[model samples]
Target chain A: MSGFFKSSIGRKYAMALSAFFLMFFLLQHFAINILSVFSPDAFNEASHFMGTFWAVQYVLQPVLIFGVMYHFIMGFILEIKNRNARVAKYAKNNGAANSSWMSRNMIYSGLAILAFLVLHFIDFWLPEISTKYIQGDMSGLLADSEGFRYYEELTHKFVNPLRVGAYVIAFVFLSLHLTHGFSSAFQSSGVSSMRKEKLQIFGKVYAIAIPLGFIAIALFHHFNH
Target chain B: MNLTLKIWRQIDANDKGKMVDYKVTEISEHMSFLEMMDVLNEQLVNTGEEPVAFDHDCREGICGMCSMYINGEAHGPDRGVTTCQLHMRMFKDGDTITIEPFRAKAFPVIKDLVVDRSAFDRIQHAGGYISVNTSGNTQDANATLISKHAADEAMDAATCIGCGACVASCKNASAMLFVGAKVSQYALLPQGQVEAADRVKNMVAQMDLEGFGNCTNTGACEIECPKGISLENIARMNRELLKANV
Candidate 1:
């Protein structure tokens, strides 16, 4: 019902849904990117398919963009409303006494991730869009050589130490963001209590492993480039 | 015990409040926190000064009327206890303790250390009870056999004293734990089945209208709750709402 979506719990439910979508997208994206570390040819093949496939390009990409935007916009609205809930703040709130620092500071970590997203978009997404759509180059080929453009471009981007440092830091923030967010999404989605402990354990593993994998990729390309 | 207290002072709701320092000496370590406050109030009355105003009813902690943010925590440093039940022995001698009223847009300050928690009453009014005729036609006891687990869960949920500590301790000032407890106490029982959907919908709508924040699942509420209410109640409420909407 329309009333459900308009309620506070409804808004949080929407947020959790979007978060799940984005998190799933991150997993698939990481899966493809990590291939570059193992085998550049496989990564190139996968990237080429994902880049040129009509369903992925037209349908999934747009949905992915919408999901990311929805999560951020809803997050901001919730943050503002929550801030307004307390007109006056306590002189001393020992948040660490009752909750984890990561849980208390989701907005800050989200902002950090958002900043990293801007950099990421500029570094990779923009160029990919410009090349494929604006320049009308569907061929996943390098102009200078006879090899696939995906792997070379991926390696080239990580050659800069500063960029790699920024990326590593961003992945760390992403890890922190996931530390609380992973299980929280399920909780918001109305998961039962019996499975919560297992979800938490799994959430911890995914939260740390995925970002650590991404960091390894960045460091690998940076050092081995 | 000798203690310095920095307690919030406000004459009325509209007035801006500030912390005023007072020293109390020769206080017994076994004195309850409210008794310590009473001692300070006695001192103030002797000097022709207005004493700090606070809310308290049953000193046994069952009433949930005593609310204070002591040393930056709801219900003070002690776990599973309300402010009235917090003993002075928890603090060391010569310590300076800060006392504050619960702060939330929904829970406005009526006076020093007292907030208007009638918003909770409004939410309760929305749908916290089940309506049944009791004009000499009440059902016999044990008419409906409920599972012991279900009864236990319902009783656990019912243990909530309507204290606003969950909201006070929450970083976002969310009332989900309180509402969740209220909803679960009904949802787990067969008597609450008839209007379960309407109850969740209306209560949540009223909760939003009251300007309480949404739950972010930080679990501070469970930790700070005097009755040890679980976050499972919240998840159950979420499920009930989802089911109601569908």
Candidate 2:
């Protein structure tokens, strides 16, 4: 087990597994968030279930926290190791011709995503935690009217142009990160094959589509009357 | 033609290398990249200076012995050819060609233009070959009919000469292509079925133990490989490793 963590492929396996978890989390989060745009009642009900469920709070949340930390930390460690792997760089490196820009610059895009996570946690996760644990004022968090707190808080957050711009830009970076990372995770996990082009196509579509959907939600909220 | 050569020079493994410039003139276009270096070495020998050291044998490009990172590309700029097969016509008369050894943490510089590639040998020893009953009458591998596509893929993978070009060209200095090709060569063939699980696991373990970096799937290895080994080999290895893990 110790030897597995030290191995390069093993480290990559961890990354692939964690990334898969995060990808599923992204899809789930997207679904819930997208619901708020149309039906706040459904959104509130789902959010209530997600928020109040003891198994989700205790079990899955901890797993997600660990997964996020593990994925992000390992990414940085791999980046540093990769840098040290090449002690001396080429005097003239034509990396563009050899591979995709996103593939080579994974660390940069990853750092950007990490930065975005901080703002994300502060905006959403932190407030939910405060409402649940710190203040212990659950009723203060509810807005069951046509003016749903679920919709209201999200729309209010997007009303700030800078914040909306940041969200849009972060999602753009997310797309870039996933452009290489999506297919790459499958490649690392051995889910990809030579005979089938499904993974690659699915990867590109997901990379583009998911981020675009997130951007749409952000924009839709910002423009909400 | 006159050319300015910027070659890496170092006395030993511990010593730091610096690019030393030299002039080689009146070169023929038909001369190979190594022959051009030989011409420069002859000039240095005629003078009172120490000649440059480089690795080369089987100058026809089969041995994978001729390793050089020339002008940023592994085995020079010519596609699908090792340093031994690269001709002078690829360069202009006044070209300033910068030559350096392959740089990877796993491949420490032994001297000028030569690094230790024993890591690859160790990896190969780990699980690169199959255990056959050579002591007794063995089943001839040729007796069985393999699909042409599989055979061709195996042939393509078997073409890897262990040149370390993949490591040199990769940003992360990953040896995935080298190990991938070796693993794929056997994985695609029927004879390699018995120890397939152990082979994948052992080779990958050895590869990681060799201080090599992880594959980012950059495809640099295939682009710069002298033999044009396909990236599908790496994919096959990944599949095999997954199967092994399962």
Candidate 3:
């Protein structure tokens, strides 16, 4: 079993597993975030549940953090090793002739998404942590208002045009990353070729729709705020 | 056709190579790419200069001996053909062709355009064969009934001639397609089932030890392959490896 994790295919398989976990998490995250546009009350309730539920806080959140870290660290390790394999670069490499740009430039897109994640954590997660743990304010409330603080915080972040622009750009990069990554995860997971074409179609839809939905949510909050 | 040839020239493995320009005039378009190289070499020999060395044998393309990265592509710009099989008709007059050896850390350039692909042989040595006994007590050839689909897919995987085009065409210089084809060629058959797990594990380990990169599914290897080896072979090998481990 240890040997399995050490082999090239094994490493790829492990990367694929982590990617699958993160992609699923992204879907759920989008699902909840989109609720802010339709109904802020429901969004706040969902956010409060996810933020403070014992099972989520004590169990899944740690696993999600580990998954994100593993994916990033392993991706960098693989990229470095891959670069070292060819010490001499081709004098003229026509990469566009065969592979998609998104497929070849996954690392750059990932880095962009990573940058966005830092911003995301600062805007939401850090404040939430401080409120719950440091301030011991588990009421999920506002200082001057009677309503939950989650929706207010969420909408307030998008009110700034510059922040909204950055969020939109990050969502575009996320789309690009997912365009290759969704089907690629299956290929890395050793899924057979027969079902691959259908999965690719589904992957395309999901890649485009989820990010577009995120962009709409951001724009809606920015305009409404 | 008249063309300017910018060919890589190197004294030996230790010497850094450079492209030397040589013009060949009145060349027939019907000539194969290697034949044009022959003409250039003959011109150099007549001029008291050492001819550029390149690997080629069985100019028909099955030997897999000929390997050249022409104009930023393995096996020139033509599809489904090795360098030896490429013809001058693919180019026009006044076209300047650039030819270089396949580049990879594992495939060191031996001379002008000849790279040492012994790393492939080492990978094959690791676990690319079955353990069938050939001591005159061999089982009947028709004993096992393989499905037609399996046989065809295995044959497709087996068509890989071991040329390094896949590696050269790959941006990462990955040999996953080669190893994948080799693994699939065996794993698809009943004869190769006995040592399937060990074969994939050992072959993959040897491939990594050769310093080849990992596959990113760019599909370049499949497109540039002389035999049109499908990307399916790669996915199949991935499945085989996973099945072996789990």
| lDDT of the candidates, in the order given | 0.94, 0.87, 0.92
Considering the two chains of model 1, state its CAPRI-style docking category. Answer: high
Provide the TM-score for each candidate, comma-separated.
0.99, 0.92, 0.98
Please give the range of 10 consecutive residues that has the lowest summed lDDT in model 1 chain B: B132-141
Taking the tens digit of each residue's C-alpha lDDT, what string does model 3 give over B45-100? 99999998999999998999999999889999999999999999999999988888
**Candidate 2, residue A111: how far the Cα is off, in Å:** 0.8
Q: Any runs in candidate 2 off by more than 4 Å, and if so which?
A: A1-6, A39-42, A139-147, B135-138
User: Native contacts retained by model 2, as a fraction?
Assistant: 0.55
Q: Once superposed on the true structure, which residue ranges of model 1 sit more than 4 Å away at CA? A: none
Please state the error at residue A94 of candidate 2 in Å: 2.3
Q: Local error of candidate 2 at B8, Å?
A: 1.0
Give the per-residue lDDT of model 3 (tens digit) for A19-99.
899999999999999999999999999999998999999899999999999999999999999899899777767778778
- On the 0 to 100 scale, the lDDT of residue B48 in model 3 is 98
lDDT of 2 by residue, A1-225 (tens): 555556687788899899999999999999999997888778877887788788998999999999999999999898888878878776666677678899888888888889899999999889989878998855435444443355566777888989889989989989998998988887776653653367788889999999999999999888884
Expressed as tens digits, the lDDT of each residue in B104-219 for candidate 1 is 99999999999999999999999999998889999985998899999999999999999999999999999999999999999999999999999999999999999998899999
lDDT pick, better of 1 and 3: 1
TM-score of the A chain in model 2? 0.94
Error of 2 at A195 (Å): 5.1
